[model samples]
Target: MNKRIDVKEAVLEANRLILHTEDSLSEIKGSMNAKGQMLVDSDQLAFIYLLETDEDFIYAGLPHTIWSKLKEALDKSLPVLLKINDSEVELVQIIDELQYLIDNIKGNANYGEEMETKVTEVFS
Candidate 1:
Protein backbone atom coordinates (compact mmCIF):
# COMPACT_ATOMS: atom_id res chain seq x y z
CA MET A 1 0.00 0.00 0.00
CA ASN A 2 1.14 3.57 -0.73
CA LYS A 3 1.02 6.37 1.75
CA ARG A 4 -0.78 9.55 0.81
CA ILE A 5 0.69 12.99 1.22
CA ASP A 6 -1.24 16.21 1.60
CA VAL A 7 -0.29 18.34 -1.41
CA LYS A 8 -1.78 21.48 0.06
CA GLU A 9 0.20 21.04 3.26
CA ALA A 10 3.41 20.46 1.35
CA VAL A 11 2.88 23.57 -0.78
CA LEU A 12 1.99 25.71 2.19
CA GLU A 13 5.10 24.58 4.04
CA ALA A 14 7.26 25.32 1.03
CA ASN A 15 5.83 28.80 0.69
CA ARG A 16 6.39 29.45 4.37
CA LEU A 17 10.02 28.43 4.09
CA ILE A 18 10.56 30.53 0.98
CA LEU A 19 8.97 33.58 2.54
CA HIS A 20 11.04 33.26 5.72
CA THR A 21 14.19 32.92 3.66
CA GLU A 22 13.35 35.98 1.59
CA ASP A 23 12.57 38.03 4.66
CA SER A 24 15.93 37.15 6.23
CA LEU A 25 17.72 38.10 3.04
CA SER A 26 15.87 41.39 2.90
CA GLU A 27 16.73 42.14 6.51
CA ILE A 28 20.40 41.47 5.84
CA LYS A 29 20.33 43.73 2.79
CA GLY A 30 18.60 46.50 4.65
CA SER A 31 21.01 46.26 7.56
CA MET A 32 23.98 46.26 5.20
CA ASN A 33 22.68 49.38 3.51
CA ALA A 34 22.10 51.05 6.84
CA LYS A 35 25.67 50.20 7.80
CA GLY A 36 26.92 51.72 4.51
CA GLN A 37 27.87 48.43 2.91
CA MET A 38 26.26 48.70 -0.48
CA LEU A 39 25.80 45.42 -2.29
CA VAL A 40 26.45 45.68 -6.02
CA ASP A 41 24.82 43.91 -8.95
CA SER A 42 27.11 40.90 -8.65
CA ASP A 43 26.21 40.62 -5.01
CA GLN A 44 22.57 40.49 -6.03
CA LEU A 45 23.50 37.69 -8.41
CA ALA A 46 25.15 35.89 -5.53
CA PHE A 47 21.87 36.02 -3.64
CA ILE A 48 20.18 34.32 -6.58
CA TYR A 49 22.85 31.66 -6.65
CA LEU A 50 22.35 31.08 -2.95
CA LEU A 51 18.60 30.72 -3.38
CA GLU A 52 18.96 28.13 -6.12
CA THR A 53 21.90 26.05 -4.95
CA ASP A 54 22.92 23.71 -2.12
CA GLU A 55 26.05 25.78 -1.79
CA ASP A 56 24.97 26.87 1.65
CA PHE A 57 25.14 23.27 2.86
CA ILE A 58 28.60 22.96 1.38
CA TYR A 59 29.98 26.07 3.02
CA ALA A 60 27.95 25.81 6.23
CA GLY A 61 27.14 29.50 5.79
CA LEU A 62 27.08 32.16 3.14
CA PRO A 63 29.62 30.62 0.76
CA HIS A 64 33.16 31.51 1.78
CA THR A 65 33.90 33.72 -1.24
CA ILE A 66 30.83 35.85 -0.76
CA TRP A 67 31.23 35.84 3.00
CA SER A 68 34.82 36.96 2.64
CA LYS A 69 33.88 39.86 0.42
CA LEU A 70 31.07 40.92 2.72
CA LYS A 71 33.30 40.51 5.75
CA GLU A 72 36.01 42.58 4.11
CA ALA A 73 33.60 45.38 3.47
CA LEU A 74 32.31 45.24 7.02
CA ASP A 75 35.81 45.04 8.45
CA LYS A 76 36.79 48.17 6.59
CA SER A 77 33.78 50.16 7.65
CA LEU A 78 33.56 48.94 11.22
CA PRO A 79 36.88 50.36 12.26
CA VAL A 80 36.06 53.76 10.92
CA LEU A 81 32.75 53.69 12.66
CA LEU A 82 34.46 52.66 15.88
CA LYS A 83 37.11 55.34 15.61
CA ILE A 84 34.45 58.01 15.13
CA ASN A 85 32.32 56.56 17.92
CA ASP A 86 29.58 55.72 15.46
CA SER A 87 27.05 52.95 16.10
CA GLU A 88 27.95 49.34 15.24
CA VAL A 89 24.52 47.97 16.07
CA GLU A 90 23.32 47.75 12.48
CA LEU A 91 26.45 45.97 11.33
CA VAL A 92 26.11 43.46 14.16
CA GLN A 93 22.50 42.93 13.23
CA ILE A 94 23.51 42.16 9.63
CA ILE A 95 25.90 39.49 10.83
CA ASP A 96 23.18 37.93 12.98
CA GLU A 97 20.72 37.94 10.11
CA LEU A 98 23.27 36.35 7.79
CA GLN A 99 23.71 33.51 10.27
CA TYR A 100 19.94 33.18 10.57
CA LEU A 101 19.72 32.93 6.80
CA ILE A 102 22.28 30.16 6.75
CA ASP A 103 20.33 28.19 9.30
CA ASN A 104 17.08 28.84 7.45
CA ILE A 105 18.54 27.70 4.13
CA LYS A 106 19.85 24.53 5.69
CA GLY A 107 16.39 23.66 6.94
CA ASN A 108 15.01 24.48 3.50
CA ALA A 109 17.43 22.08 1.86
CA ASN A 110 16.34 19.28 4.16
CA TYR A 111 12.71 20.10 3.46
CA GLY A 112 13.39 20.00 -0.28
CA GLU A 113 14.95 16.60 0.04
CA GLU A 114 12.00 15.37 2.05
CA MET A 115 9.58 16.66 -0.58
CA GLU A 116 11.57 14.96 -3.33
CA THR A 117 11.43 11.66 -1.49
CA LYS A 118 7.71 12.00 -0.97
CA VAL A 119 7.11 12.66 -4.66
CA THR A 120 9.18 9.70 -5.67
CA GLU A 121 7.34 7.42 -3.24
CA VAL A 122 3.98 8.63 -4.47
CA PHE A 123 4.82 8.19 -8.15
CA SER A 124 6.88 5.03 -8.00
Candidate 2:
Protein backbone atom coordinates (compact mmCIF):
# COMPACT_ATOMS: atom_id res chain seq x y z
CA MET A 1 0.00 0.00 0.00
CA ASN A 2 2.14 2.81 1.30
CA LYS A 3 5.38 0.96 0.54
CA ARG A 4 5.87 2.74 -2.77
CA ILE A 5 5.71 6.13 -1.13
CA ASP A 6 8.04 5.06 1.62
CA VAL A 7 10.60 3.66 -0.81
CA LYS A 8 10.52 6.77 -2.94
CA GLU A 9 11.03 9.01 0.06
CA ALA A 10 13.80 6.82 1.39
CA VAL A 11 15.63 6.90 -1.94
CA LEU A 12 15.50 10.67 -2.12
CA GLU A 13 16.67 10.91 1.48
CA ALA A 14 19.55 8.51 0.84
CA ASN A 15 20.76 10.65 -2.05
CA ARG A 16 20.69 13.71 0.18
CA LEU A 17 22.63 11.84 2.83
CA ILE A 18 25.27 10.72 0.38
CA LEU A 19 25.73 14.30 -0.84
CA HIS A 20 25.96 15.66 2.69
CA THR A 21 28.55 13.09 3.72
CA GLU A 22 30.67 13.81 0.68
CA ASP A 23 30.57 17.54 1.37
CA SER A 24 31.35 17.17 5.05
CA LEU A 25 34.23 14.79 4.44
CA SER A 26 35.69 17.24 1.95
CA GLU A 27 35.34 20.17 4.33
CA ILE A 28 36.81 18.31 7.28
CA LYS A 29 39.65 16.99 5.19
CA GLY A 30 40.68 20.59 4.53
CA SER A 31 40.42 21.58 8.20
CA MET A 32 42.94 21.39 11.02
CA ASN A 33 42.89 20.50 14.69
CA ALA A 34 43.66 22.68 17.69
CA LYS A 35 47.29 21.57 17.52
CA GLY A 36 47.50 22.70 13.86
CA GLN A 37 47.54 19.11 12.74
CA MET A 38 45.19 17.56 10.21
CA LEU A 39 41.92 16.50 11.75
CA VAL A 40 42.82 12.89 12.40
CA ASP A 41 41.06 12.02 15.60
CA SER A 42 38.45 9.51 14.50
CA ASP A 43 38.03 8.58 18.13
CA GLN A 44 36.12 11.81 18.46
CA LEU A 45 34.30 13.48 15.60
CA ALA A 46 32.37 16.75 15.61
CA PHE A 47 29.28 14.57 15.71
CA ILE A 48 28.56 10.89 15.40
CA TYR A 49 25.63 8.84 14.20
CA LEU A 50 24.67 5.35 15.35
CA LEU A 51 22.65 2.76 13.44
CA GLU A 52 22.26 -0.99 13.77
CA THR A 53 23.08 -3.11 10.74
CA ASP A 54 21.08 -6.00 9.36
CA GLU A 55 24.28 -7.94 9.57
CA ASP A 56 27.20 -7.29 11.92
CA PHE A 57 28.44 -4.65 9.52
CA ILE A 58 29.75 -1.35 10.83
CA TYR A 59 29.56 1.97 9.08
CA ALA A 60 32.87 2.38 7.24
CA GLY A 61 32.58 6.10 6.77
CA LEU A 62 33.88 6.77 10.26
CA PRO A 63 37.46 7.08 11.40
CA HIS A 64 39.11 3.80 12.34
CA THR A 65 39.37 4.70 16.01
CA ILE A 66 35.70 5.47 16.36
CA TRP A 67 34.80 2.57 14.16
CA SER A 68 36.76 0.26 16.41
CA LYS A 69 34.97 1.59 19.44
CA LEU A 70 31.61 1.05 17.79
CA LYS A 71 32.60 -2.41 16.69
CA GLU A 72 33.77 -3.27 20.18
CA ALA A 73 30.50 -2.14 21.67
CA LEU A 74 28.51 -4.14 19.16
CA ASP A 75 30.62 -7.22 19.73
CA LYS A 76 30.09 -6.98 23.46
CA SER A 77 26.38 -6.34 23.06
CA LEU A 78 26.85 -2.99 24.77
CA PRO A 79 25.39 0.33 23.88
CA VAL A 80 27.79 2.82 22.34
CA LEU A 81 28.37 6.26 23.83
CA LEU A 82 30.00 8.08 20.94
CA LYS A 83 31.97 11.25 21.63
CA ILE A 84 31.15 14.65 20.20
CA ASN A 85 33.55 17.26 18.85
CA ASP A 86 33.14 20.73 17.28
CA SER A 87 32.22 20.25 13.62
CA GLU A 88 28.54 21.06 13.25
CA VAL A 89 28.41 20.57 9.51
CA GLU A 90 30.28 17.33 9.84
CA LEU A 91 27.78 16.18 12.41
CA VAL A 92 24.85 16.84 10.08
CA GLN A 93 26.56 14.89 7.32
CA ILE A 94 27.20 11.89 9.56
CA ILE A 95 23.60 11.93 10.71
CA ASP A 96 22.38 11.90 7.13
CA GLU A 97 24.57 8.93 6.31
CA LEU A 98 23.23 7.10 9.33
CA GLN A 99 19.67 7.69 8.22
CA TYR A 100 20.55 6.45 4.76
CA LEU A 101 21.91 3.28 6.27
CA ILE A 102 18.81 2.82 8.31
CA ASP A 103 16.63 3.13 5.24
CA ASN A 104 18.65 0.65 3.24
CA ILE A 105 18.81 -1.83 6.09
CA LYS A 106 15.03 -1.73 6.21
CA GLY A 107 14.91 -3.02 2.63
CA ASN A 108 13.91 0.21 0.96
CA ALA A 109 14.77 0.30 -2.74
CA ASN A 110 17.60 2.76 -3.38
CA TYR A 111 16.20 4.05 -6.65
CA GLY A 112 16.65 7.80 -6.43
CA GLU A 113 14.16 10.45 -7.64
CA GLU A 114 15.40 10.07 -11.18
CA MET A 115 13.94 6.59 -11.18
CA GLU A 116 10.48 8.08 -10.86
CA THR A 117 11.10 10.38 -13.80
CA LYS A 118 12.40 7.47 -15.82
CA VAL A 119 9.30 5.44 -15.03
CA THR A 120 7.06 8.30 -16.17
CA GLU A 121 9.04 8.67 -19.36
CA VAL A 122 8.65 4.96 -20.14
CA PHE A 123 4.88 5.12 -19.61
CA SER A 124 4.44 8.31 -21.58
Q: For this target, which candidate reaches the highest lDDT against the unseen true structure?
A: 2
lDDT by residue (1-124, candidate 2, tens digit) is 0000000011112122211122222212233211111111123321123322222211223432233333333334342221223332222233334334333323323434443333223222
Error of 1 at 64 (Å): 7.3
Model 1, range 13-103, lDDT digits (tens) per residue? Answer: 2112111111122112222212222111222222211111121211112222244434443343332111001212222244444434344
Task: Report the error of model 1 at residue 79, Å.
Answer: 7.3
Q: State the RMSD for candidate 1.
A: 18.9
Any residue pairs clashing in model 1, and if so which?
A: none
lDDT of 1: 0.25
Off by over 4 Å in 2: 1-61, 83-124
How far residue 76's Cα lies from its native spot in candidate 2, in Å, is 1.3
